[model samples]
Target chain A: MIEQVADPLPQTGFAKVVLELEVNNHPGVMSHICNLFARRAFNMEGILCMPVAGGERSRIWLLVFEDQRLEQMIRQLEKLEDVLAVRRHGAEHEVFERLEDFFH
Target chain B: MMQMTGAQLIVRLLERQGVRTIAGIPGGAILPLYDALGGSELIHHVLARHEQGAGFMAQGMARASGQPAVCFASSGPGATNLVTAIADAFLDSIPMVAITGQVPLSMIGTDAFQEVDIYGITVPITKHNFLVRSVEELLTVIPDAFRIAMSGRPGPVLVDVPKDVQNQLISFTDFPPRVVSDSLPPVDAEAIEEAARLINEAEQPVLYLGGGVVHSGASALAVTLAEQACMPTTMTLMGLGAMPVDHPLSIGMLGMHGARYTNFVLEEADVLVCVGARFDDRAVGKAAQFCPRAKIVHIDVDPSELHKIKRAHVAIHADVGSALEALLPRIRKSMRKRWLSHVDSLRSRFPMQLPGMDDPRTHYGLVRAVAAALDDDAIITTDVGQHQMWVAQAYPFRRPRQWMTSGGLGTMGFGVPTAMGAALAEPDRTVVCFSGDGSLMMNVQEFATLAEENLNVKIVLMNNSSLGLVYQQQNLFYGKRVFASKYGAGPDFIKIAEGFGIGAVDLDQAANPRAALAQALQTPGPCLIHASIDREQFVYPMVPPGAANTEMIGG
Candidate 1:
């Protein structure tokens, strides 16, 4: 759990971030993301997402590693197009939190 | 009026256009161009081991540097050798200038020694081609050839200079008017706004990124619109590197081998915002069933692609980045928590897992480890086979333009040759290739080019002692009736590679597979990491020919 520190230097060692999406809300989407992370080598610790309170759409969060070659990293998230705020929340990122191993 | 040579005029034109290098093979007809190169200070001519490799090398440089690169070949074989690369560059939309020498102008249509219809052979593959007759025309046409190649829907352009033209050097002069600025049509504003409004109102949204994103350099805007609108995204094979792997919004790729979730997500989306992606059959399996439910919003710089396959609910004619910028602010942002969770579940369920590699030296284990180690930043070029599919299905590709393949053509012998281009474009970046026994054999001659050009390409040959993919197809579809899909009675690839002076390591004997890979990757010159794979292994997640996109078989 990376605590939200005051304006840290964008958590530099290969920063890891997550975005929870609910586009398809099926078993297949998560597999796609997992396989995607594996292929791209983004070690996702866990993805704790499910049907939200309203249940009209789904939510998904993926953990990923990035560097200054980071624009493409960000582009990958936005490409999902269903992603709400690909909030960079993880280790060596702007926001930090302790996530249980639900994604594993 | 003074007598002048076309080669001298060409040199002057190329100098003005900032062309510093030319990939070529010296021969009988092109000696004048080579002769013209002796005293020139600006252009560096690379004597390629093969003229075909020369074209690919130039294509590679052009693709990487975003500048028009040049290749030269002599008459007959030299000109014919460059054909494949020229066609590839044409389809891939790489900016290249191919200059082939012909027989003396006096020997027209006589089939003189070392004379071939180089210009005619190249016309179909090039954006534009010219058969030079006079030295006077060289001053303006040489620079114009380069200009046309680099501008609009960038592609290779050919200029066939006759042997006589190269010998007659008139006084060289700078020709600045050759480059045209307003040659192509301007972006259509009505179409752009229609796409933006559709996006602004959509509930279930997804964006399909393609090679156009990379071509337009609009990757940043692609991310912006997807994030701002809470849209899920997928990419075509050519669009692999537009984003990086591991972006949460990215749902892998969409194609015959694309992520199951991607197909399903697009299937359900209300508005599919397609940016710079043509609905190629490879990317959109059966066109009818592809995104059947989504109201497609197609945008591309090429107006023709709008209704080429799937008719767009809203079609836009603008570059993706510029379009995204124009449309981003217009779209209302909403909290689609439910939408997010649904895509997340799809991501979790159909995880692309390969058979676990128990041994380090085994092909299965090595590819998985290498794929995992290299992750997203690494660009992998593959020769077609079980290995290529294995990489396609099992690997995660979140970024656009990350995966480059002859998707539409599926040409064999493309891996190493294309890798030469990919490596040259990004000299500092690592370019890895997965070649099969059958696939590597087609273009084995590329080894000399890889070495001579000094391109950094790491090849992982999945030598199954057979034509693995063909065999797998036969076994599955033809009841294992083996025909010509055997490679057991052939030259040993490692030995063959060694003959070309490239490093080779058998995956069987290598003690530490990962270490061997690291060492090979560290090697500055071209190297082969041959991993003998299971000949019986078949590609999974395959939708049996003519079956629905959802009916994918194998894990």
Candidate 2:
């Protein structure tokens, strides 16, 4: 069997951005979202998820580099049936900035 | 108020959705559903030898009827076996629903016997998937599966029902209403107007059709648009039957293995109207170089596809049928005499050459001979490889949904079972599958299903005793170091067909091959017509992988 190794460290040059997504809270929703990024080899630097709308929907925040394929990635993410809405923000978004110390 | 087990409710819901036939195999986990299906007079179950075969059979029905079809499999290996067929349907955008029986909800995470994570496995492949947590969820999940499969861009969906859920009793006042496709995404009138203006203004515009045309049932409208605008039209492989190959404006399939003149026409196009077709790598070689000179007008139902490849000057996000209907009134009739004459000149210079079209023993000849025996009404399918490309080049497909092949997934074992599915859906039409020797063996076990069903499906076996496409690629690009492509010894396919209780004929030994072929096809309930093609014969007018469409090797 072929062994899958962890993805190498993301290339350092590109600027980072944050993506906020509203999704249907369900068991496989995370799998669908993660599979898209992994299959495309698009790296996600940091991620967070929490239920909103009275536990009916989940909000996910993703921190990643703003590369050429980012626009295409956003379009793909929006295509997911469970994904209700997607909002893009620059690195200044407080959602990830507040959690920076936890990662370190 | 009505009360029923989950399995009984599933059967009733499927019947309400107008599913007359289901292809599947019953196993331990799926037995409850099978038992429910057994009691239904409206639905007929086709017992396929393999789960993969069952999957392709559902695909075949969906491809032929343009409606979502269903297939069933049990847990573990049964569900695992179904992965390829589901993937094939997903890539081709065929509407299908695959229901698999899982271990009881409690045993899902544990390594229970005959259990697999099919819902998770099929996530990347299906339009959507469901893991039914309760009997109540079945009411919503079943209808939702059909809705998701048929709405917008059609694709396969999976509903994984735990064995316990199948047996669980649920009470509801009434069943949910049978589903239909979701309302189409609103069309951008401004984008449509701009696209029309570009086509009307450009001197040399090519209309590129894809599988979306067939899915939207807009083939006639597409042909009309091509004629009104005096544009030469080219089809992707999946879009073969959208325009009759012999039509005056038709340029045949474009890109890899396309006729030399067809790609040349695309090279000179001032504007490209790409409708309902994604710019797949095989269809558009080297994306940056494809239609470099042309401004693109891309119309599709999927918003993600509009600017994904070859940015569209005017991107219309709507149903192909609706978008074409809007554009027809805006387009002006033009003679395009100079451009047509240029195309004609190029066509005469570099026509698709068929070296051995007269002799029934040769590859091209065999495809032509089959076409001669059958009319445009016959449904034609092919397994992947040289036989598939050869048939794509030579077959005279004149109508939409008349040609079905694995275009995106290119699964090898697709031909036989899919042909059976088509025959099952449209029992009146004679279905023919053009299969290579290697592809035939992949799902040859399905011959038994064909014999049992006794549908009119003919298998035209092109026996070369090798994986022809790989051998050709090795010869052309890999310095002729052919490895593991050729068979050292082959089975007697004639005896194998007979063993499977289907009639077989070997054209190699026939005194009159054409007469034999015609007889087998015309009198076919389920028949295998085998002809031995030369191992050396290669599908030509080939574009080496990643090369521009203009850089072809041989014909």
Maximum-TM-score candidate: 2
> Candidate 2 on B208-248: residue-level lDDT in tens?
99999999999999999999999999999999999999999
Q: Which portions of model 2 miss their true places by more than 4 Å?
A: A1-10
In model 1 chain B, where is the ten-residue run with the lowest total lDDT?
B173-182
Residue A95 displacement in candidate 1 (angstroms) = 73
Whole-model lDDT per candidate: 0.72, 0.94
TM-score of each model's chain B: 0.92, 0.99
Total clashing pairs for each candidate: 75, 0
Q: Per-residue lDDT for B80 in model 1?
A: 95
Best by lDDT: 2
lDDT of 1 by residue, B65-133 (tens): 667889899999999988888888877777889988999999968989998887666655776677788
On a 0 to 100 scale, what is the lDDT of residue B473 in model 2?
A: 88
